[model samples]
Target: MASTEAPEVLRYAAFTGDPAGGNPAGVVLDATGLDASRMLALAAEVGYSETAFITGRDEARRRFSVRYFSPLAEVAFCGHATLATSVALAERIGTGALLFDTPAGEIGVDTVTGPDGKVRATLTSVPTRSRPAEAIEVDATLAALRWAAADLDPDLPPHVSFAGNDHLVLAAASRARLADLAYDFDALTAVMRTHGWTTVHLVWRESEGSYHARDPFPVGGVVEDPATGAAAAAFGGYLRTLGLVTAPRTVAVRQGEDMGRPSDLTVEVDPYETRVRVTGQAVPIP
Candidate 1:
């Protein structure tokens, strides 16, 4: 990567085994000499929600320094891109444990090949955290989304959650409410920039351990994210913190179905651990 040669960017769709069913991300396995400006330019060219770059590596420790960039700017962390990068690495280096030093924190990734010959990656996120969203902030967000307060789920409440990056979590009162997602992009972008929010994690609880989600990522210069592992990680903490779900639970998230690219993610929360684990399969996009 240090060389001046053009970097080889690989494309992969994360959270689904099918190439067309998940979030697409660009992976630059070797990005040694690429500067921030070049990386950002490359990310914009790749044009996914985000692209992952491998800037440094340690062979003995199976560790690498990684950075994620959205089409607009650099991001603190990106779960789908992390999964894509891990699988891209595993394809060449063989599946096993890999550690990534990210701007947010150290992320632990484990990759294994399933019986169906698909590579599945599980990422362990940084410590999760959350706080109640201010009333004004909620009101502004609701206004931007064109949703009423009645559309909010009483049980979930409004909170800003963090698992590397900050996200505004809003639960829908019903599935229909979640499905109707026409919003003022510029207004929501303004609100997110003001609050340092990465995405608006709009969701609906389908059952005790299952949910559907849609993430508005205007901050990332994207209309929506097909699958959002970082938000799912933060949500696990939100659920645990609110006593909505008991610890040692696994939550199934179904995203992108409404967008035509269905994605599935499994989030695991441990009783004693603060970090959340998100697992999904990634496939090369031809």
Candidate 2:
């Protein structure tokens, strides 16, 4: 039997240039004839948190229609995968703006080489919205995570924010709390399923502009996300909604260190808008 897939898929690590760091995502740059089942199969074969499939393209406009699949199901939008895909395209097509027609909305990405000679990319998210988390929902989440009320940061209240997907924003009281991430995966999965949550954004604020984050994504069949660009974008909106930070500032969210895959994401927010801009560089994972 021969595989009919064309334009061989590429592997890249997003949020960090180091091959060993960042979250790995499979990129099918040209998924001309690939269907939903085939894409999911490919993603499972790749065994990454997610895989990005570019179904349609406009060479003249440098635009593409992208779909994301996890090992289990499809995703509305995936920031790390988008970054990985942009980096892959930039490596071959040269750095510039690329448009993506995603399930969530149309997104614009710009790729550029930093002063250090790394190919970095920035993605602008769709309009974001945040609402207070219901008491029962928050309580169940805290219990599933094995965290207590004292473990939460008093300054940052519990909220559910959405950019491309829904995520529960939980602020831990200390870095130590965020570091120890032994949670009940099944319990969390059940809670998330009930609430339609993609990830729980566990965070510890190091400073006004610096933060540490971990995402438990049991619903995706992953214990934790190495780097979560979508959650970073949502967190930016969360901060804005809560009046936690001044707008038009860049906040750094560090993740994957505890998992031994240190990743960095820069989230920018403007005072007047609800969209968040996330930036990071990716490298091919050979």
| Overall lDDT per candidate, in order of appearance | 0.94, 0.92
Query: How much is 3 displaced in model 1, in angstroms?
Result: 5.4
In candidate 1, the residue pairs with backbone N, CA or C atoms under 3 Å apart (3 or more residues apart, or in different chains) clash, namely none
Residue 149 lDDT, candidate 2, scale 0-100: 91
lDDT digits (tens) for residues 186-279 of candidate 1 = 9999999999999999999999889999999998899999999899999888887787765598999999998999999999987677899999
lDDT of 2 by residue, 1-286 (tens): 3246555779999999899999999999988788888888888888898899999999789999999998888999999999999999998889999999999999999999999888999999999889999999999999999999999998899999998999999999999999998999999999999999889999999999999999998888889999999899999999989887664899999999999999999999886888899999999998
TM-score of each: 0.98, 0.97
Question: What is the Cα-based TM-score of model 2?
Answer: 0.97
Residue 84, model 2: lDDT of: 98
Off by over 4 Å in 1: 1-4
lDDT of 1 at 279: 99
